[model samples]
Target: MTPPRNVHARAALLMLGSTLGFGLMAIFIRLASKDIPTWEVAFFRNAFGFLSLLPMLALPALRQPRPAAAFAASVRTDQLPRYVIRTAIGIASMFCGFWAIAHLPLAQAISLAYSSPIFVTIAAILMLGERVRARRWTAVALGFVGVLVIVRPWSHAFSLGSLVAVAAAVLSALVAIQIKQLSQTDKADTIVFWTYALWVPMSLLPSLFVWRWPAGIEWLWLAATGLMGTVGQLLWTRALKLGDVSALTPISFMQLPVVTLAGWLLFGESVDGATLLGAGIILGSTFYIAHREAKLAREQRSKAPSEAVEPGS
Candidate 1:
């Protein structure tokens, strides 16, 4: 079925914006890495990102009589344990991801990072006890083939950097599942607040070991990393809400090209045939998996009673 033209256009634009934001984020991370440790970069990113959300949290207060209390109420949550778990997994992913971007070819790191959905499929089956048929299993297998193509451990193409990128994807998949559970009980705002609130300190420990004040433009790059990441994330969430996952998932791959171009232009990085091929394979496999999931979901919704369900829920 065709989505409404205007709706799909809006979603496409949002996804493109998100792609640019994230591409710039990788660029900024590399720039910051020249002078600052990746761990400190993570710490500053969280601290600035957490601060960036204050105005957003305050928006809710404007609607209520007691602004201060309303703001406090918005931030209050009973889900500290869940937030801690989620933040731990997320911080680990963040660390691994930063390390990869700082250490690996930008295209390779970003391409492997995109394999999170593959891991999510397996994680869902294992952790959530969700049933999957042979088809998704095949798609998942194909996704691994893409990973191997990129890594190619038998050849010089392989390195710990490649493996670290894949590990980041794996932890990211777990974070996705954890967020799914938390979303059931926590408002999106509450979850966002605590994740960053806790991430600030969680990422701080390792950072202190290497802490040196960011000098001159190192400060600018560090701050831009936080802004770009946060804005990209918000746009990504918005785009998914507006468009079909099957469609938006492919659009998100535009990030790879954006980063690939930036990597070559800014850092003089070279991309090889394997990285391009592996990235394409991963993109194809993921798009197919998303298409299949959407089709089955539609079929299931049709079979159930005639109650209103969210279009993309």
Candidate 2:
């Protein structure tokens, strides 16, 4: 059955809020990073995000063991090795992401962040041994062109900030691939819990090297980082459950503009033409790639006619 119209509307609204939450979370990360070490900011974000996930554990049915699955449905997962690998890379990505937010122009940083999917496509082909066609190859090429447009490492256009953001994107793409591997065996909640749980300890070790107390309202900024990150994820999860991924994914790009506006109004940062043009090019390419993937998935489903995968599963 088709989702009700109201359901679609609600999904749109939820996705909108989710984007806003994350956009603001980036702002908060920048604010918090002004006074705190990047690693420390990441740790507190993980620490508080994990705290917010506690209420989810209270849902009785979520923890039930799946007989066929290798892992249970609770906070614990049997995928220790996988979790360890993912956590390490994810923390590195978070560190880069937060640092970029603090150092780069918000628009430029956000633009570079969207380059993850381009890297994802490359990683999928190399690591997953997946075959690719000319269309996706072309899209990936175009995506790289867009990245170069933004990075402009040779001239005054992009430098360390762009490089850091790109590193974050690359690491993030690797994490995405790892998550795909884990999702083949573990439940989403178990993966999420383990991610944040493992991140707290993993992220803490490095943070100690640069740790200092949060001065004044810096504590509030840190708190907002955790809270908004968690809220955005929760809202995003719900929105995806209620709407089509193809319909919702584009709404996420709204985050760039929201964050850019915040950067201007709050920090007096001005965005330049290269960033916007580069961002548009990158977005267009990634959007096409996503559209193709979704279409291919739909075609596969039509061919096999299996039971529909449950939301978030």
Candidate 3:
């Protein structure tokens, strides 16, 4: 469904804010992961985030569970099976992504995951039956090439962490496709809430095998990480709801620059020439994809009949 113009403007701003918050959260996660185990960090992040939302969820408007099968409804209820599937995929993606950030350079982790959009485009075509036009296909191809540049697999031995980040991107793409499918049958809040609600237990399983208590300061950082993540997710969902995905997506690329700067200032990491070049390519391709999507949306709207009547026909 087409959103109003005001929604588009708000979504764009919110998406930009979400990316910035996300980039900062990555930095904090990396810092906290230094002294704490990855699983512990992940657990705390989700647990604290869930606790933080208690007040919001308590509100009468958001209290009831969202039901599936009514795409536009403000409230909804169970589609337990779909939530289970999406939450599982999302948990894996988050687990691997957090682990990757803890182990790899922050910029590298962020850059690698940026490939998710390319994966999303492919999934949309293959699984969702979205048409693959020539320009979009070209953009998809270019985006992957940019990822290859960043990975540079042929030049050096690939790290397991790098592979994990790539896997995270693939899983994230699948989850996103699931969201798209669910959007056809469910309200946005229902899908978002269910994914998080179910993920808590699933994420706890692996952490249980290796869980350890964090120190006082570590707990604070972990709590902060969760807060940032929760806020970021809220901003992200709100953004997409306000505008076309294509219009809001390009703003997400801002995350790379934000993370890169954070890594430099906070961690003393340098941005190599290769990384910069690869980032440029990825950004360019993503911009093209966003432009194409917005163009397509506009074209569709233009072809629809106007509500206005002709003068005294």
Candidate 4:
């Protein structure tokens, strides 16, 4: 058996690999956007992602005693409503995110999207009725301040792309909350498989209005984006299975720097001083929030065994 320490190290590395895959996906999105419309790009992304996941779905079927039943079980019909809602939200988020990536600097678009964790925290309070203590509230406040710093609303620095990116973050938070609820009754694979299955058709509708077949290397980038996205999702899930979420959460921030470096090297995009400062502040708040949540989870787990014992015993 693998040592606990080794498991953690492997998880951390998987998380890093996941981040790298995401960074590459962003780059490919940018590259493909040059020739393809954002709507079409979104469609291809979901379509190709769904196609790439077929092998995963098929592999399970081959190993099961009842292949047909196993295949059907992978997509639970009872959960279709929730999956539809989740996929709709995810499609909207993807459309907005792709548009922002097409219009804004890679770093700026990614930085704005990073605000999803803050939105998720707020959503948990309002939608899920989860209580937030003062420290987390403080972190939320700092996160908003960081957003203002990056956006500079009163100045000319603000643009529609920034607003769209923030909208995407909000939608993404909603998706995250939905996933939290779904995880209670469904497996992760079911959730992912259904989302991609549903998303392909939903994304295709809007894409028809803007449809233009990709030519030349455009096909390569679009396919790469989908493949990278699917691979990244797999890595992220594996990482969570192997390590504590808190240990992996901080590692995700590594994507911003990786993207920033890619932006500089590939596109000659330079991040402004204020943008960098704001990103740092936002990341710091997110890190704190994740750390606090992890600490609380650890405490709860530690107490569970003791609480289970009889008082007399």
Clashes of each: 0, 0, 5, 0
- Residue-level lDDT of model 1, residues 126-161, one tens digit each, is 887777777888888899999999999999767977
Question: What's every prediction's RMSD, in angstroms?
Answer: 2.7, 4.3, 5.9, 3.5
Model 1 regions more than 4 Å off: 1-3, 305-313
TM-score of 2: 0.91
Task: Estimate every model's Cα lDDT from 0 to 1.
Answer: 0.87, 0.86, 0.79, 0.87
lDDT of 2 by residue, 1-313 (tens): 7778999999999999999999989999999988799999999999988888766644555454653232333555678988999999999999999999999999988888998988998898788876678888888899898889888877865577779999999999999999889988887787887888799999999999999989889989998999899999989989988987778879989999999999999999998888888999899888888777777766667766566432110
Clashing pairs in 4: none
lDDT of 2 at 29: 95
Which candidate wins on TM-score? 4
Better of 3 and 4 by TM-score: 4
Worst 10 residues of 3 by lDDT: 304-313
Clashing pairs in 1: none
TM-score of every candidate relative to the true structure: 0.94, 0.91, 0.86, 0.94
Model 1 — which ten-residue stretch has the worst lDDT?
304-313
Q: Would you give me the overall lDDT of model 3? A: 0.79
Using TM-score as the measure, what is the rank order of every candidate, best first? 4, 1, 2, 3
> Which stretches of candidate 4 lie above 4 Å from their native place?
1-3, 305-313
Between candidates 2 and 3, name the one with more favorable lDDT.
2
